[model samples]
Target: MVSEEEGKILIRLARKSIESYVKNKSLIDIPEDTPETLKENMGVFTTLNKNGMLRGCIGYPEPIKPLINALVEVAVSAAVNDPRFPPVSESELDDLEIEVSVLTKPELIEVEKPEQYMDKIKIGEDGLIIERGPYRGLLLPQVAVELGWNVEEFLYNTCVKAGLTADCWLFKDVKIYKFSSQIFNE
Candidate 1:
């Protein structure tokens, strides 16, 4: 578990990175005092909200880089590259809330059929990833809690997000993965 102090440090770094990138087209240099726990390879997501609604969110689903570096990269991307919204303007800086979700590596959920997924998935706790062929989609854990989706609904939405039919999860070839996240926000 991340200490509260470390969580705060991560949040501040994400905020600074988003603000810097939005205002000046630059990424903040990593801080000098980053804790060793934060330097470990970890996947991270940065979410930007304005007035309690999603403005932008993006992340690495796999642990490809140090937690701190991935956080900075995704924080900036969430500000400007999320296709669902327009780029955040400098004027919006003060109003944005930054959330950082540090994710556990996703583990494949093995089962003979789709129905078993409900047994493995825990609402408000497990994030979902559905993949088929070249298509894939991930919904963070908080998404289900925030949207109040039950396990099946979560599966349906995740399928649609992967650009597949809503019933695709029922297909035997589909792959499902679950991961948990440590989430904190400003």
Candidate 2:
């Protein structure tokens, strides 16, 4: 488990990194105080919003660099690369709320019955990734209540997002994984 102090440091460093990037209009190199040793040890996601509606959400599934460095990349990516929405505008920054979720390693599951998620899954705690037939979709763990979606409904929506049949994940080739995260809004 990460200590509270460590979490706070990451939060501070992450926010600073984003602010620097925005100010420079380019990705800034990770600062010396930012922990580079833990880059590959953490995965990060960024969710941006305005007036409580989603603006952009983007992340990496596995730690590619220390958490702070990853945060810089993700925060910028969420602002610019979320295909679902246009790039975040400077005006939106003042109105925008940012959220950071640091994910744990995902657990793969074999589902004989898809409905099993109701009992086997714990919303708000388990980030989910569903894959089948070259299609895949992922929802950070906190997505459940925000969308009011049950497991099947959640999976179905994910399928739609990935351009697959809702039931496509029922196939033997399908893969499922659940992970947890530490989430906070800025």
Q: Highest lDDT, which number?
A: 1
- State the lDDT of candidate 1 residue by residue for 88-126, as single tens digits: 999999999999999999999999877999899999899
Segments in model 1 whose C-alpha atoms lie over 4 Å from true places: none
Which residue segments of model 2 deviate by more than 4 Å?
35-40
Tens-place lDDT per residue, model 2, 1-186, is: 455565666656556655666666777666666444444568888888889899888888776666777777888888878898987766666777788888887788755786666677777778788877677788887888688888777677767766778876566777778888988655
TM per candidate: 0.98, 0.86
Instruction: Report the alpha-carbon TM-score of model 1 versus the true structure.
Output: 0.98
Give the CA lDDT, 0 to 100, for residue 51 in model 2.
Answer: 92
